[model samples]
Target: MSGHGFHVHGPHDHAVEHAAHGSDKFSGNIAVMTAILATVGAMFGYQGGATQNDAALFKNNAAIDKTEAANRWNYYQAKSNKQNLAELAMTLPGADAERYKADVARYKTEKDGIKKDAEKWEASSAEWNQKSDAAMHQHHQWALATTAEQIAISLAAITLLTHKKWLQYTAYGVAAAGIGLGAFAWLHVDPIGALALKLGMGAAGH
Candidate 1:
């Protein structure tokens, strides 16, 4: 994971120049290591893409729910205004008290219905918010997986450049870490709760 692959051997290092880059065995081994890294990179890349798609979909849903909730509140406000007008009319003199009373009663009934609808919308918005948070958690998991895989690939590159078998072994360790991250992403297991942090772009109930 570090950029320290250019380590230089001491004075006698050139003694092994006979087995330099032209050796078939060395080339073959480096090629194989590269191939393995490529395979793992591709798999993790696909997983990252799919995770992004899901996050986008959840964000869209959250937006829609929040908009609907706002609309319901607006409707509730309109009903309240009408109710206020009706009550004011009832306070005014003689325009047929019965008609004013009837209007007031009608407005009150409408307000009750509007109140219930507004409350329902609010509840629905909250549910959508919870769903969005869960999706975001998964998105973070995928991000972690992708990061690990990228580091592993870099390590593999160093392995090829330095022709150090130990570097390749270190690459394997990094690759295993990447695989572990992928497994955690797939299983939705974030023991540290770090994945719960919001990306702020796709949050619901905003």
Candidate 2:
């Protein structure tokens, strides 16, 4: 099929008619396999896009929270400076010491509230950062799975062209790998990270 001034044809497309009329079933098998791979690849691609969007959104939220935290901290610093000035006034010869003490106490209370608010925003930012990291990791997994499916589809095309039984089997293997990766992504498991953890533990044991 061609669309948007681009023509797309697989190697199998050229041999499809020839293989259909052949006495063997290779053509039919490759056709079915490619069709299945295409369907699965579409699903993986959609999931990848969704997770990527989630990652971006979550990261944006994290940035917003971080900015809020910074603003609160800046406010807290301003309050501290005012408190210091009040305390300095308490030591001055002509200043009302009692009024300066009250001001100092009020500023302490305000600073406490600001500090708590800043800490809450920092925690929220950290939580959002974690979620973004998770979504990005899942997006990578989906992308890798989609890549696997594309490779399988390519192998299917080549198998149809060369009629190589080995190529067909290889395509099936790659398709299975794609499915496995997709499953891991769906389950929110990072296989590569798990493997690394295991290896690190083993090394530590040694």
Candidate 3:
């Protein structure tokens, strides 16, 4: 699902329909699980799309700020060149040295202001870039969670077909992993990195 769009997998729906018709505890349970997983997957897909859009918007903002910063820097450079020219004029034998000196000072002041503006825009660009990266990371996490949910649903379908006990267990495990990934995404934590850090800390403690 993306934006206002919604979709259902035909195979999963067919499996769900078959499960719903059966008059057994196993079929009923599988049906319910599939339904729940479908809902969760839809939600995760939507969140993934939203985060991706946010990342793009933030990246665009970063580019705009970067462009503005470049423009300001260019303007600052122009002022510097003018200031240098004025200083050169001040060195001429019959030039109005005082007027040229005043011009140089004015250009210096203008350059300072432009430089400040450029720096401010550069900082803003960096902040936006960071936001873009964060949103992109969240999007990837949601995508992973959604993929896990999809795989779980597929496994559940296969279990329905084969009536295999292990397939059901595998589906449950996959669904749990999906939920864990979603939680990590919600908390803005990198699961792999966090796990690595924890292991490293435990090792160092010894």
Off by over 4 Å in 2: 1-6, 10-23
lDDT score of model 3?
0.93
Model 3 segments more than 4 A misplaced: 1-9, 196-206
Per-residue lDDT of model 3, residues 8-45, tens digit only:
66547967798778888887788889899999999999
Output the lDDT of residue 119, model 3.
99
In candidate 1, position 37 carries an lDDT of: 57
Per-model lDDT: 0.69, 0.91, 0.93
Question: Of 1 and 2, which scores higher on lDDT?
Answer: 2
Q: Highest lDDT: give the candidate number.
A: 3
Q: Rank by lDDT, descending?
A: 3, 2, 1
Judging by TM-score against the true structure, name the best candidate: 2
| lDDT of the structure predicted as candidate 2 | 0.91
Q: All candidates' TM-scores?
A: 0.71, 0.92, 0.90
Q: RMSD in angstroms, all models?
A: 10.0, 2.4, 4.8
lDDT of 1 at 199: 39
Model 2 TM-score? 0.92
Model 1 residue 152 CA deviation in Å: 1.6
How good is model 3 by TM-score?
0.90
Deviation of model 2 at 157, angstroms: 0.6
